[model samples]
Target: MSKLVNKSQCVVICCFPANYTVGLTTVVEALALGIPLICTKNVQMPMDIDHEHCGITVEPGDMGGWEKAVNYIAENPDVASDMGRRGRELAEKVYNLDNCAKDVSAVLKTLIKK
Candidate 1:
């Protein structure tokens, strides 16, 4: 999976625009492997895929939007590569396992204290 993701130009996540699954680990996994992304709106968050330049987001059923996004990546290979690099950096520096573990531990400690 890592190899495939890294080799790919981009990853496309097809989900309902309103389906709020932003915290899905798959997004992190893809980013960690340095793959650019194109996903439905609301599929990812915290990292702000679009704003962070890690990916593009489109409305759920918007085929035209999908085409434009795909074309953008295809037409601009350098930009796509940059997006992947940014995604990898974001994953490593912010969404790494160590950070997640620490966050979970903090919450657990708080619950225990309560």
Candidate 2:
């Protein structure tokens, strides 16, 4: 899946059971690879995509909305590319391991000081 995702133009993450939140790893990988995404709204990282304008989100179980989002991306290559770029930027800013570790270390230090 990693290899395939790396080479893909876009990724679609469909969460099952309508309300379950999953697929964070796939979302991270897609963002790291600068691939635009079409994702179900119930997934764990919908806000990451929405706030960053990194992808299109559809309500879970809404097949029509999903299809429409996919078609919109397919027809608008430049828009899709921009979304991919934004996704990569968001990933670097928010999900980078070094930055995350630094944030955790800061919190721990504050707690220890108190």
Please name the candidate that would achieve the greatest TM-score relative to the true structure. Answer: 1
Q: Estimate each model's TM-score.
A: 0.85, 0.78
**Local accuracy of candidate 1 as per-residue lDDT tens digits, 33-62:** 888899878833566688888989888799
TM-score, prediction 2 = 0.78
Cα RMSD to native, each candidate?
A: 2.1, 3.5
Instruction: Give the alpha-carbon lDDT of every model.
Output: 0.84, 0.83
* Stretches of model 1 off by over 4 angstroms after superposition: none
Best by lDDT: 1
lDDT of 1: 0.84
Report the lDDT tens digits of candidate 2 across residue range 6-85: 77768998887444358777888788899999987764454557668899888878989988999999999899999999
